[model samples]
Target: MIKSEIKKLPGSQIEISVSVSWDEWEKYIELAAKDYSKEIKIQGFRAGKAPRDMVEKKVGTGALMDAAAQRVVQGTYPKVVTEQKIDAIGKPQAEIVKLAEGNDLEYKVVTSVIPEAKLKPWKKEIAKVNKEYEKKTAEVTKEEVEKEIEEIAKSRVQHVDVEREAQDGDNVILDFEVKKDGVPIENGTSKNHPMILGRGVFIPGFEEQVVGMKAGEIKDFELTFPKDYHAKNLAGIACLFTVTLNKVQERKTPDVSDEFARSLGKFKDLEDMRKNVTEGMEEEKKHELKEKRRGALIDALVENLEVEIPHVLVHEELHKMIGEFEMQLQGMNITFEQYLIQIKKTVDEIEKEWEPQAIKRVKAALALEELAKEQEIEIPAEEVEAEMNKALAQYKQIKDIEKNIDLARLYNYVKGMMQNEKVLEMMENVK
Candidate 1:
């Protein structure tokens, strides 16, 4: 195996150019043939049943040659980098350096990797936060539960439909058409869509338009979409909507009875349902409070951090956030393109919005890494194993993904994240 020094590039790229001798090339061919033999086919044999020589001939010299090259690069590149004590990151760009039988197998793999960073000194500033928070008692009081019950009960509360006009919080069934410049905006008209007043799910000020509309009332209103609206096309544009009330109904969420509790499934009575909901809320509150503390601690650490966060990592994190945002939009039956059209933004525009958050995450990661060093926070192998197992279980729906994933990469990422959690907790308690 021919070895070479890795070349460092901006944004975590480590490039290594290398060549293999004829012996090495032959070895790679054998390796590739073993991995790919089942797929090879040739004349005078069943599919994938040809002899090695026949398959190689049928597949063409070039195909086997390329495969041989890939085998050598894929197997040797990372091993060489590791042996040479060079850190590589992400997926490297592999290029054929040379290709000729009996000459040499040659290639270069450019990998993006996280660089070594200095750990920041743990300071006294973070200790006090933990102390103060520790002093505050966490409670899931009965009063709070009762309050939640009352709020939910209000939704199902019996109400008389007044002859007057419907107001905010009153239910109205209506048909509406939205238009721009006297022409209907695409997908802007609705008939008998069940809309709840005061839900706030509509665009800002949309729910307000329905308030005070009496039965048989026809209302036309023009409003401007907020510039920051999730949809691009309609963002910051004023449009007109024509709404006609088809019916008015008051909500009575079936009084807090046994029947109502059973309707929701799994409750002995109203009190049982309230208790369960309260517990759930209590857990949610605890999580939220913990998150706030963690966020504050991370903020502090990043504020004091010193290091160059790889742009690659920032982009990766940003991409994850974008995927989540897109998923949420998808759940609402909106595509990313549709969202862009509605908000009048391209994917790049969406990316720009998340850039700041990405930077913050990267900074926090660097700070946490430093903090982890200072605190000697070591993630146990068992923890990494457990994390991997969990991830693998989730990969069942993804074909070939379990095998294709680079486990070392996943382990490092998870290990770093776990250490960061410890670092944040330490920072939160730092005085």
Candidate 2:
């Protein structure tokens, strides 16, 4: 027989004390001894074929008792949780309280459980937001269309080498290196980099210094980084730059006309091109507006949600956010360690700063889950499978797709996504 006691702890955690009878302990001891026989050497006996007495004598009473306690705890914790109807999250932390040869086993297990989410009235809030969004139109102004057209024309601009000093609106190719206090800065050297003058793409004074330089001209100047520069180490610091102008090219932007449209190989005329651009801008604006509305909906839901979020969930979310941040840094060709050095902050400090956001994200997810439950929204298995298959297809070109992907985890993620979508759609379409 097994005896147990359960206590609810703060922060959505539960503690369970379980005691197993001596008979049960003895059974596990025998099993443990049998397991040890395969690994423990005994004279005149084949591996795993030694008798229990010899196995126990060889492995010692203490080792056998420890192994038995482990087995007993592992075999009993799940049964206790299931019998008690505990909705545990993450892993249970186990601690042995009592273990001895020929005696009962006792252990304590602490685990986090799902918290109760008491949600406020959110349907009306979502309906109001949806109504507000419905009243607003995603309209693209003529100026916006013209601006996009100008950008397209600029993309097709021709650059012709000219033997003249670099000027505003002229493309300049240059080699440059920046140094602070006579020491070269990392990632501050470039060769044959091309930039158009008057773009303000470089430092405040750097572009002006290049404006008068002709091809083959080497000029040295000093500039101060902006006080609010993204790299904290270089912010508000003076740096010396040595720039060698290699080439100057005058830029000629094409006129937006029927000929330009024909050259694009898709539009029939300038009017057709304008129409497509306008439509594209409109679609983009609509998407932006839709995203804003979705954000507002989630914000409203989170505002009305009341739940004690588990620290474990927030910790998990923080690590997920960190992973995403690391990926973004990688995209910029910066290592995470280098980013930390540039920002002058430790990972712990960064995570502390992101804690509130992590908590908010957790609350928002809980709110969505509550809404789904209230609405009885469920994602079909077939839909989850289809989405999983679609996701898998994207990575099918990679070798060993099955080994690389956790299919069970991917399925759960897809199902959660589908469920959230269904719930959000219901809220959006609430009459």
Candidate 3:
């Protein structure tokens, strides 16, 4: 028979004491000895073929009981938790209280429990933020719209052959070589390279000297690299560049008229294009404003939460955020280890730096979940299915993920997302 005693501790913690009868302990000891026999050697006997009495004599009853007690704890913990109905959060910490040949095997487990979340009047705070946002205006200026139009026109420009001398804003094709102290530098020679003057595509003063040079003209110039140039050897050093201007091409831009707008497709005229651009800009501004409002609401919600968040929850969130950061680094063709070296920090230091933010994020999540529960917010089955399908479609590009999808876990994730969205919508409507 097994027995347990449960006690509630301060700060949403619980202590459970579990005791196993002597008969039960003896049974586990025999089982553990049998398991240990498989790896023990005895003279004149094959492995695992030693007599039980000889095996006990070889490994000692104390060592055998110790291993048996470990197994007993592992096997009995779940039954105690389910019988006692303890909502444990993270892993349970165990300490042996009594383990001997004849005494009942006893151990104590200390664990964190999920605390009941208490939230303040977050809706009122959200309303205050929303009212402030309503009074502020986001507008797109006329110059901004005109700049977009100009960029579109510039993108459509064509390079044409010209007989005049090279000028600023003209595309020049040239062959060039750079030398330092009359020694040819590595990776400093190119043939028929196309450069646009006044674009600063070359080193400062390099392209400026090319201006006014006609076709088939060769010119030589010297310029000093910046003190903070990326290559340490060339920093602040003067280098000579020999250039040959093969040809000059002038940019021919299309007229900003109805014909040009029609060529862009879907626009009837310049006015129509301008109208659509203005509308698009307005929509973008609205999205920015919405994001700002959402941020404000989350901040307010985090401030209103009054609960003791589990340390394990915050630690898990920190690790998750770090994983996300690593993924972003990978996307940029960089490794997390490389990033750590470049930033001159250890992983522990990075985790310490992110601790406060992780705590805030965990608190915000708990508060949202509590608020949703209090408000009786529920997601429909059809909506969850649709969201799961949409997510599956997005990830269908991965070769094997679609075939091995975890439908239950995906549905739960989608349901959680839908509930969060509904909660945010409620906060947005608080007036």
Tens digits of per-residue lDDT for model 1 on 340-386?
76667787887888899988977777677666667678989999889
Tens-digit lDDT track of model 2 for 292-313 = 9888899988989988888999
lDDT of each: 0.75, 0.89, 0.86
What TM-score would each prediction reach against the true structure?
0.62, 0.81, 0.71
Candidate with best lDDT: 2
RMSD of each: 7.4, 4.3, 5.7
Candidate 1 backbone overlaps, count: 24
In model 3, the runs with Cα more than 4 Å from the true position are 8-12, 23-26, 42-52, 136-139, 148-269, 380-386, 393-408
Model 1 lDDT on a 0 to 1 scale: 0.75
lDDT of 3 by residue, 1-431 (tens): 78999887877788999999888777777678778888888888887777767888998877877788888998889989899888888888998899987779899999988776888777788889989998977688989888888889989999998999999999989999999999988888999999989999766788789999999999998999877654668889999999999999999988888898889997999999999988888889989999898888888988888888778777788889999999999999999998886576899999999999998888778888898999999998998988777777787464477568787887887898889899999998899
How many clashing pairs per prediction, in order? Answer: 24, 0, 0
| Ranked candidates (lDDT, high to low) | 2, 3, 1
